[model samples]
Target: MNIAIVGLGVIGGSFAKGLQAAGYTNVYGIDVSESTLKIAVDQGMIKKGFIEANDILQDMDVIMISLYPNQIAPFVEQHKNRLKDGAVLTDVTGVKTTIIEKVSNILPSTVDFVFAHPMRGSEKQGIIGADHKRFIGANALITPIATNKEASLQLIEKLYKEIGFDQVTRVSPEKHDEQIAYVSQLMHVLSVAVVNSQQASEETLTYAGNSFQELTRIADINAELWSELFLNNRTGLLKSIEHFEIELDALKHTLEENDDERLKAIFRQATNKRREWY
Candidate 1:
């Protein structure tokens, strides 16, 4: 397959390398930066690199767009005509409802856009941080619409698995967003909150333990990208935040009342619920 990846940033670069590792030699990359494209080609992650979509869109059998949430729809609209007939297009956007609706409306009948979210990433940014190994043991979620072809959905799932994802599950776009808001976005928010809640001190790390370090690792985030993700899924994320706040308030009340039994019960409940994931 002639696979083309748009936006040769961390995720895109990782996809290129992973696909090549899986023996897909016909991979290509498209990016706005000439330096990024040159680096991608020099590193042999892609067979060739294009600075613009018009240069390679027509020849690709599969197009994996690894752009920001806001950019996904526009990129499709701009190059929808250029995409090859019968091509399978997919994206790695974190939030999906708006993007799916917009792209689905504008997509050509000949092509299929299979919406997918690879549950893997790094705190680091750009192509420099790309690592195909990140997908190992990670889960991937596919939000397929009624119009999506079964063959195309299967192709996407197979590709993700071949590139190292351990599992791929299909769910409604609404469910995907709701779950992600809690599991992914809320985790990041908590990390940031924990980091910011600390008093500023250069010596803070000296007192930190493994748990503190691990918990705040994602606090070193891509602010602009995360801000967009938070805003795009505002409704779902707000609901998640409200739920978390309620739990936090209950804990605070328990502490105020010096209710040791209640605190222990709460901890036990949490531990039991968490153990189920394993």
Candidate 2:
């Protein structure tokens, strides 16, 4: 398969490496940075690299857009004509409702765009931090729109399975955004808030336990990338935050009223719900 991965950042670079490792020989890396392209080629992540959209992309069987949410539409619009007919286009972007709606309107019917989200990442940035290990046996979500082609969805699911995703669950864009707001976006928000709430110094970190470290691991985030994602799905994110606030207020109320039984009940319920995941 001739696969083209746009934006050679961490996720894109990881996709290149993962696909190559899975025996896909004709992987191509595309990025705006010439140096990044050269690095990708030298690292053997991709068989070829391009700094700009060209005739080479017309031959691509699949094109995966790994750009930030805000940049995805412009990238597709700029290179729409260069995309091959009957080619399957997919994305690893987190936010989907707006992206799926806008891209569907702009892209030609000759090509198929399958919107997908790979629910795996690190707090690191750039191709230098790319690792295919992060995706091994990870869960992938295929958020399909009404206009999406059945064949395109099948191709993307197969591609994710081949790249080592253990679970591939399909959902509508609405449900995807609603659920991700809690599982992904809201967690990032909580991490950032928790890290910033305290005034930490060297002395404070010296006493940090594994619980603190685990909670704050994702606190070291990429602001530029996350800002775009948060804004794109602001409504759902805000709703998730509201729900969290309600639960937090309830806990605070229990503590203020000295309701020991209520607090224990809440903790027990939370523990039971979490155990369902395992």
TM-score of each: 0.97, 0.97
lDDT of 1 at 267: 97
Global Cα lDDT for candidate 1:
0.93
Per-candidate Cα lDDT values, in order, are 0.93, 0.90
Candidate 1 has what TM-score? 0.97
What C-alpha RMSD separates each model from the true structure?
1.1, 1.2
How does candidate 2 score on lDDT? Answer: 0.90
Q: Please write out the lDDT profile of model 2 over residues 114-201, one tens digit for every residue.
A: 8899999878899998998898899999987766789889999988888899999999899999999999999999889988885877
